[model samples]
Structure formats: structure tokens, C-alpha cells
Target: WYRQAPGGSLQWVSFISTDSSVKKSEPAMEGRALVSRDNSRSESSLSLRALGPRDSARYFCA
Candidate 1:
């Protein structure tokens, strides 16, 4: 969901979401955006990144 590029215009990167609840009929966004959602309480703690590394990326949720 992120690129290693530093402030350079790049190609369109295909995004994939593992959450079945995350359904998008149509959506478009620009720039760096931190997305968070509490879809299910049972899913309190799970893998944050399935396609890439969670690493030192700073993220937060309510």
C-alpha cells in the first residue's frame, strides 16, 4: 500500500485489501492517507500488512 520512492511521481501501484469488509464500489484518492476502521471487535489484533512489511511505519487507530 506504500512505495519506497521518496517524493517522486511514480506509476500506478495496484492495491489489495485482505479485509472482506472493505468493499469499494468506486473510490479514488491522492497523497499519503492513513486509513483505519474498527469493523469488528473480534478482530482486535491481526496482521496489519499481509502484502508487505509493517516495519517502522507509524500508524494509529481509534
Candidate 2:
């Protein structure tokens, strides 16, 4: 999610899953706004996909 602060700067926020998925043991994950900086640095830029039930979770903005 993104919001404009009183000073007019934008802020982003988000979440990420740490555990591996059933599809790939070392899967590539992507997200919006807030990023899970906790994850390890990798060689390539990961593209994020919109989450459906197939992804097992949905991102919500208030």
C-alpha cells in the first residue's frame, strides 16, 4: 500500500512468506509496496505476481 504523508512523501508497506512452498523448494517470491527485506539477496530481480488462492494468501490494504 502507498500513502502520502503530511509532508507529501509516499510510504509503502507489505508482507512475505518465509517458508518454502509445495511447488518449489527454493521458489522465487515477489511482493508489492512493503517488501520482505529479511529474505536473502539473490542474483536476479524477482517479478511479483498477484496472489490468488493458488498462492494460498491475499494481500489486503486498509
Candidate 3:
């Protein structure tokens, strides 16, 4: 997943493998975001905690 703020470049947020393993996450999101995958559903999701005004941004997954 990646996040791009208004007028800012895209930044890495988190990476999870097809097999449901978390590979990486940006230091800034270490405690603020949670990335996970559900193998049975073949799905992935990102959860953000304690959101603030500064958290507004575009999120992408590829």
C-alpha cells in the first residue's frame, strides 16, 4: 500500500505477501497503521489508528 498527500509524492505504507505475510511498513506508520491479509478470503486490508487531519491522503494498493 502507498499514500500520497496533496501536492506530495507517494510514500510507502505497508507490504503484505500473497501468502498473508507482512513484509514491510514505513517507520512513520509503525504504530499508527496495521496491515493484514486473510488467506481464506484472499484479501488484504490496512487499518489506521488515531487519525488526525494530517492523515488525509490518497491510498493505493497494487
Candidate 4:
């Protein structure tokens, strides 16, 4: 997962795998983001906590 602010380069958020392991790429996201996956459906999700104005950005998953 990644986030891109206006005019800013893409910023790494977290890494998730089918094994259900998550690696945070940014310290700011530690404890503030949650990553989960459902292998049965081949779907994944990202949850953000306590959002604020600064949190506004374009989010992407690859």
C-alpha cells in the first residue's frame, strides 16, 4: 500500500502478504494503520485510525 500527497511522490505505507504478515514502511503509520487479508477471496484492506486533515491523500494498492 502507498499514499501520495498532492505534488508529492508516492510514500510507502505497509506491506502485506498472503501469509498474513505486515511490514510498516513508515514510522508514522506504526500503530495507526492496520493491514489485513482474506486469502479465500484474494482481498486485502487497509484501515487508518484517528484520521485528520493531514491524512488526506490518494491511496493505492499494488
Candidate 5:
């Protein structure tokens, strides 16, 4: 997962690992944070905290 800042710079964010060996999620970008995670179903879900003024940016997941 990544977030594009106002200057169009892509910042690395939390990473969802499919590998069962890996435990917790990776760290998120500075000033940003992860809010929720739901992996009960086949498809995993991630929710970020409320967006602040600087939080405004285009997000992408791969």
C-alpha cells in the first residue's frame, strides 16, 4: 500500500502479508497511522484513521 502526497511523492504505508509466518503489519508512514484490520474472511480489509489536512492524498494498493 502507498499514498501519494500533495507533491506527488509516493510514501510507503502498512503492508498486508499473506504469509502466515509473518505476524503484525509493517509500519506506516510518518504522521499517518492505521486504524483497523479485518481478516476474518478470505478478503482482508484495512481502514485508515480519519484524514487530516496533510492526509489529503491519492491512495493506492497493490
Candidate 6:
């Protein structure tokens, strides 16, 4: 897990389960987005890069 601190840096928060099936549904982001999300069903992978400032926040799985 990670959080966007007030200074705009990613800070580790906690350990997340490595189990791929544990992720929650993706949320809506106006500008920032996840790529290869469809591969999640096959347990491939999803990546997020170049996230917008507004996309900064806490993230968790399950």
C-alpha cells in the first residue's frame, strides 16, 4: 500500500496480500488510468504511470 504525502511523494503504508484475486474493483479517475486492466482477469498485470496530481491518495487491495 502507498499514500501520497502532503509533499507529493509516495509513502509506503502497509503490506498488501500478493494474492491477485484480492484486488477490489478499479475506481474512476478523470485523467489518471490503469493500463492492461483486462489482463487482471487472467492474472496478468495492471500498471499505472504518469498519474495526475489529483490521482494522488491512499491505495489498498481487498
**Pairs of residues at least 3 apart in sequence or in different chains that clash in candidate 4:** none
- How do the predictions measure up, each by TM-score? 0.19, 0.21, 0.80, 0.86, 0.55, 0.28
Model 2 Cα RMSD, 1 decimal? 11.6
* lDDT at residue 11 of model 5 (Cα atoms): 70
| CA shift of 12, model 2, Å | 0.8
lDDT, candidates in the order shown: 0.33, 0.33, 0.85, 0.84, 0.57, 0.44
lDDT of 3 by residue, 1-62 (tens): 99999999988898887875546788878888888888788778899998998779999886
Q: Which stretches of candidate 4 lie over 4 Å from their true place?
A: none
Clashing residue pairs, candidate 5? Answer: none
Span of 10 residues, lowest total lDDT, candidate 6: 29-38
> In model 3, what lDDT does residue 21 have?
53
lDDT of 4 by residue, 1-62 (tens): 99998888999988887688645657888888888888889898899998988778999988
Count of residue pairs whose backbone atoms collide, per candidate: 0, 2, 0, 0, 0, 0
CA shift at 16, candidate 2, in angstroms? 8.3
Clashing pairs in 3: none
Per-residue lDDT value at 18 in model 1: 49
Candidate 3 stretches with Cα past 4 Å from truth are none
User: Which is the leading candidate under TM-score?
Assistant: 4
Q: Which candidate, 4 or 5, has the higher TM-score?
A: 4
Error of 3 at 14 (Å): 0.7
Root-mean-square deviation of Cα positions for candidate 5 versus the true structure, in angstroms: 4.0
- Root mean square deviation (Cα) for candidate 1: 9.5
